[model samples]
Target: MGIRHIDVRLCNGCNICVEDCPLDVLRLDEATKKAYIAYLRDCQSCFLCQSECPQDAIRCVAVHERRMPKAW
Candidate 1:
């Protein structure tokens, strides 16, 4: 695993990220009812999805090292 970003509270499975991402790195999980970073290595860290998220639950952070786990 590389790095990851997700806002479960803000993510409503609207699939906006799926439609907006140019890299095709995001996906919606039907079972968990949330968004998943299928290819985190492909992330550009552009904050596009974060800006599109209406719930304001998205955030970008470094993934090479470990700091906090399970954060939006």
Candidate 2:
């Protein structure tokens, strides 16, 4: 497994993050006016959205498994 969990508070609902996600994992929460990644397994670790986010809200972090090494 990879680090695909997105920080919701950091998201600004700018939609840039959704556009940059090549894996189609990110989806806009029409109700919350934020972004959500429903298909995390599809993520490819490409930090395109992070690079385009003006608010610096989008980020790609490594989600370390319990039995695995801690996140750096």
Q: What's the TM-score of every candidate structure? A: 0.70, 0.68
Across residues 22-61, which tens digit of lDDT does each residue of candidate 1 receive? 7788888989778888887777666787778776666766
For candidate 2, lDDT tens digit of each residue in 39-65? Answer: 776666666766777877666765532
Q: After superposition, how far is residue 55 of candidate 1 from its true place, in Å?
A: 1.1
Best by the TM-score measure: 1
lDDT (0 to 1) per candidate:
0.72, 0.70
CA lDDT for candidate 2:
0.70
Model 1 steric clash total: 0
- List the RMSD of every prediction in angstroms: 7.8, 5.3
Error of 2 at 3 (Å): 5.1
Q: What TM-score does prediction 1 earn?
A: 0.70
The top-ranked prediction according to lDDT is: 1
